[model samples]
Target: MFFAGDIGGTKVNLALCEVHDGRITTQFLRRYSSAQFGSLSDVLVRYVKEIGPLSGKIEGTCFGVPGPVLNGRCHTVNLPWTPDSAEIARDLAQVVEAGPVQLINDLEATAYGIGLLQKSGQGLSILRAATGAIGHRANQALLAPGTGLGEAMLLWDGIRHVISPSEGGHADFGPQDEEQIELLRWLWPRHKHVSWEHVASGPALHRLYRFLKETGRETEPAELAEALAQPGVDASPVIAAMAIRGQYPICVRAFDLWLFFVGAEAGNLALKSLSLGGIFIGGGIIPNVLELFRRPAFFAGLDSKGRMSSVVAGMPVYGIVDPLTALYGAAFSAAHSHGVLHGFR
Candidate 1:
C-alpha cells in the first residue's frame, strides 16, 4: 500500500492506493481545508484516525505541493505554514513503518498524471506520421493556471517517460495588440516583470475586472451570469462563465483573448521541446471554459507560428477535465519510486 497527497493552500486531499495486479487501486480518499488546521500534521492525524491501520506493510508516500520544494521543505504559496518532507516522513514513518517520502512540485505531479494519460491512450494524440517528422513519440505539455501559472511537459525520453517542470509561465507576457499593450502599461507600475501569470491567473482575472470597473466598465462574472440568464440585459462573465452559458459576444471576446495567449504559449513550448507530444491544458481555469477553446481562433493561435506553424499544427491539444490529476500523479510517483512501475521517479 502507498499513501499520497495533493496539497494546496486552500485544501488538501489525502488518499491511499494499493498496488495490486499491476494496477493502483484507491483504498480511501478524503479532503480537508488547510485553513482549518494549524499544520498539515493535524490533517494527517485526522485522516489516519479515520482510515485506520496504516502500518508495517506500506512502502512509501509522496506529496504534490503547490509551492516550490527546496531541500525537502516546501513553503506554501498562499498559506502561513511550511512543510518539510523529512519531518513528514518521520511522523508518518511511525504509522507506516517509517519509509521514505518523496516530494515533487505540484506541476511535476500534473505532468506525471499527463504521462499516465498518454500511456492509457486516454489523452490527445497527434498524427503518427506527423510525429515521425519530428522523430519523436506523441506526448503533451500541462499548463495549470491557478493562484499562479504552473507548467510541465511529459516527453518521451527515448525509452521511457519524463516529467519536466517549467517556469515559462513566469517568462513574461508579450502584448499582442493596442488593448493588451495598454493593459500591460497599466500593470507595469505594480509589478516589475509581468508574465503570463500577471494576466492569465485567477487574481489576474480579478485585476482585469477591477481595471474595467476603474475605467467605468462593469466587470462582475456573477452579475453577468445573472443578467444573461434573464435575457434583455446582455452582459458577460469571465472567459469561463460566458463560455459555459453558450453564446454571448463579450464573453466570447474575453475567451478569445484568453485562448489566443494560451495557444500561442503552447505553440512556443511545442517549438522549444519539439514536443511531438500534444499540449494538455490543465488548471482551475480552462476546463471551465473548454467549450470556448474549440473555437476557430484558439486552434489558429496554436498554428499561428509563421514557419513553424506546420510543426505545431500536428501537436494535439487537450483540456484535462479531472480535478484529481495531481493526486493521481502523486500515486504514480509513489508507485514508481517503489519500482512498482517503470519510468517513474
Candidate 2:
C-alpha cells in the first residue's frame, strides 16, 4: 500500500492507496481541517493512529502541497508552517518506515492525476467543445481556483506530456472590462498587489460580494448580512450556495464576477502555454458549480481576447469532476517517480 495526501490551504486529504488491476486506488481516506493542526506531521500522526492496523505497511509516501516545493522544502503562502520532506520522513519513520517523503506542488499532483483520469475515460466533462478537431494533442493546461489559484502546463513534446507547475495565478490582474477596471481600483488600496488570485479564488467570493455591497452597486439583505457578519462563518460558500440556487441578486452578481475571472485567467493560461491539447479546470469551486460555469458570461470573458479570440475560444475546456484526483496523483507519483519528481521551483 502507498500513502498519499492532497494538502491545501483550507483542508488536507489523506489516504492509503493500493494498486489493483494496474490502477491506483484509495483504500482509506479522510479529510482534516488544515487550520486546526499546527503542522503536517501533527495531522499525519493523528491519521496514522486513527487508521489503525496499518503500522509499517505504507511503502511510499507523497504529499501535494499548496506551494512550490524546492529541494524537499516548501514555504506555504496560505498555510502558516513550512514543511520539509526529510524532516517529515524522520517523524514518521516509526509508523510507516517509508522512503523519503516527496512533496510536490498541488497542481503538479493534479496534473499527473488528470493524465490518469483521462485514460480511464471517467469523471471528466467537456464544458466547452473543441471548435476544430477532437483528438488534437499538442499542449494542455490546468487552472484551479480554490483557497488560492493554481496554474500548470502539460507540454506534449511530440510524444508524452511533461507536467510543469506554475505560479501564474500570482501574476498581475488585468481587467477585461470597465467594471473589472473599477474592481481593480477598489482592490488596489487593500492589497499590496492584487493578482488574479484576489478576484478568482474561493476566498475572493466574499471579497467580490463585499465590493459589490460596499460600492452601492447592490443592497445587502438584512438577515443574510447578519449571517455573513457572524464570526467563524465562511461567507464564500454561503454566497456560492445562494448563487447556485439563483436566490439573491447580490450573490448572483459576485458569482458572475468570479466566473468571469476564471474564464479570463483560463484563457490567459491557454495563450501562455499554447495548450491546444485541451484546458482542464480543476479546483474546489468549478466542479461543484459545473452548471453555473457553463453559462455564457464565463465564456464571454474567455472569448474576449482581442486578436487571439478564435485561438482561445476554439480550444476545448474540461472540468475535473473527481474530487480525489490530487490524492490519487500523489500516490501515483510516489509509485512511479521513485519517491521524487523534478520541476519543483
Candidate 3:
C-alpha cells in the first residue's frame, strides 16, 4: 500500500491506496480542516491513528502541496504553518517504517492526474479554457484559482517524465482595456505586487467587493453569498446586479477582467507548452460557477491570441467538475512515482 495526500489552502486530505492495473484502490481516507490544526503534522497524526495501523510492506508516500516546496520544505501560503517532508519521514519511520517520502506541487500532481484520465474518444485534442487531452501522457499543465493561483506543468522528455512547479500566477497582472487599467491603478497602492491571484481567487472576490465599495458601488460578497444560499439565487441575479446596475461595479469589473486575464494567460500557457494534451482548470472558484465562465466574452478573451489565435482556438480547456480531481491526481502521481503505472520512461 502507498499513502497519498492533497494539501490545499483550506483542507488537507490523506489516503492510503493499493495500486492495481493503473488504478488506486482506496484502503482509507480522511480530511482535516487545515485552519483548525496548528500544523500539517497534527492532521497526519490524527489520520494515522484513525486508520489503525499498516500491516503490510508499505511502499512509499507522496503529497501534493498547494505551496512551493523547495528542498523538502514548504510553507502553506494561507495557513500558518510550515511542513518539512523529511521530518515527516523521520517521524513515520518509527511507525510504518516505510521508505522515504516524495513531494510535488499540487498543480503538477493534478496535471499528471489529467494525463491518467481515460480518453473520451477525443483522442488528445487540445481545448482552450477547458480540460486537457489524454493519451500522450506528457507535456500538460495544471492551473487552478482558489485562495490564490497555482500552476505547474509536466513534461515527458522521452527518457523520463518530469514535473515542473511554477509561480507563474505571481507574474505581473496585465490589463487589456481602459477599464482594466483603471482597476489596476485602484489596486496598485494596496498591493505592491499585483498578480492574477489578487483579482481571481475567492479572497480576491472579497477584495474586489471592497474595491467596488470604494468606487461608490454598494453590493457586498456577504450579501451575494447569502443570496446564493437561497434556492432561486443563481449567478444571473448577482451577475446582472453587478454588471448592469453597477451596484458593485468594481466586483463586476473584476470578474469580467478576470475572465479576460484567465483567457490570455491560459492561451499563453498553451502557446508556450504546446500542451496539445489540454489545459485543465481545477479550483474552487471556476468549477462552482461554470455558467459564469461559459459566457462568450470569456471564450473571446481566450481566443484573442493575435497571430496565434487559431492555435489557441483549437486548444481544449476544461473546468474540472470532479471535486476529488486533485486528490485523484495526487494518487495518480504517487502511483506513477512509485513505478506502478509502467509508461513513465
Candidate 4:
C-alpha cells in the first residue's frame, strides 16, 4: 500500500493508494478541512489511526503542497502551517511503517500525474487541438487556478519529462484591454503589486465580481448579495455555482473575466517555456468551469502575440476534468520514487 496527499490551504486530500491490477488505485480517499488541523502530522496521525493496521503495510507516501518545496520544506501563503518533509517522515515512519513521507510542490505532483492521467483518458479533456507543428520531445506547461494560481513546466529529457516548480503565478499582471487596465487601476491601490494570481485565482473571481459591482458594470443579484453578505463564506464557489447555473448575470460576468485572466496567463506561461509538447490545465477551478474553458474566447491573449501567434496556435490544449489529479500524482510519485513501481513514462 501507498499513501498520498494533496494538501491545500482549504483542504487536505489524503488517500491510501497502491498499484493494483497493473494500475494505481486508491484503497481509501478523504478530504480533511485544513483549517481544522493544526499541522500535517496531525492529519497523518488521524489518517493512520483510522486506517489501523493497514497503514503499517504502506510502502511510502508523498504530499503535494502549495508553493515551492526547497530541501524538503515548504512555506505556503494560504495555510497557517508550514510543512516540512523530514519532520513528517519522522513522525509517521515508525508508527505507520510507511517509510519516509515525501513533500513536493502541488504543481510538480500534477505534472508527474499528467502522463498517468493521459493513460487513464479521464483526466485530460482536449479543449483545443494542436494546429501547428508539435514536438513529441518538446517541453510542456501547466496553468492551475485554484485558491491561488499555480504554474509549472515539464522539461523533456530524452526519456522522461522532469518536473520544475515555478512561482510565476506571482508574476506581474499584464492587462489585455482598456477594461482590464481599469481593473488593474482599481486593484493598484489595494495591492502594492498585483499579480496574475491576483486576478486569475478562485479568490480573484470574488475580487472580479467586486470590481464589476463597484464599477457599476453589472447589477448584483439580490439573492447572491445575501449569500455574499454571510461572514466567512467563500464567495468564489457561490459565484461559480451561480454562474454555472446561469442564475445570475453578475456571477456570469465575473466568472467570464476569471476565465479570460486564466487564458492570458496560460499564454504567457506557454511563451516563456516554449512548450511545444502542449499545455495542460489542472486545478480546482478549471474542472468546475470546464464549459467556459472550451470556448474560443478562453484562448484570447494566447494567440494575440505580435509575431508568435501561429507558434502558440499549434500547441495543444487540454483541461483536466479530474479534480483528484494531484493526489493521484503524489501516490504515483511515492511508488515510482521508492523503486517499488516501474515503467512510468
Candidate maximizing TM-score: 2
User: Of 1 and 4, which scores higher on TM-score?
Assistant: 4
- TM-score ranking, high to low: 2, 4, 1, 3
**Candidate 3 global Cα RMSD:** 5.0
207-293 per-residue lDDT for model 2 (tens digits): 999999999999999998998889999999999999999889999999998988988999999999988889999997777799988
lDDT of 3 by residue, 69-117 (tens): 8898886676687788888887676556555687778887666565555
Q: Give the Å shift of residue 147 in candidate 4.
A: 0.7
User: Model 4 over residues 122-164: C-alpha lDDT tens digits?
Assistant: 7788888876665546789999888889999998887878888
Stronger candidate by TM-score (1 vs 2): 2
Q: What's the TM-score of every candidate structure?
A: 0.83, 0.95, 0.82, 0.94
Candidate 1 accuracy as TM-score: 0.83
The TM-score between candidate 3 and the true structure equals 0.82
Candidate 2 segments whose C-alpha is farther than 4 A from its true place: 134-136, 339-345
**Over the stretch 1-345, how does candidate 1's per-residue lDDT look in tens digits?**
778888876678888877665555666789998889987777777888788865446677888887778898887666776788888877765555535788888889888776666556563323123444543264556677676777777777667657777777788888767877877887888887888877665556545544554555444455564654674442323435654574444454555566666777777777877777567777765555667668776776668888888878877667877677788788888988888877642
Q: Ten consecutive residues with minimal summed lDDT in candidate 3?
A: 119-128
- What's the lDDT for candidate 4? 0.85
- Taking all chains together, the TM-score of candidate 4 against the true structure is 0.94
Q: Is candidate 3 or candidate 4 better by lDDT?
A: 4
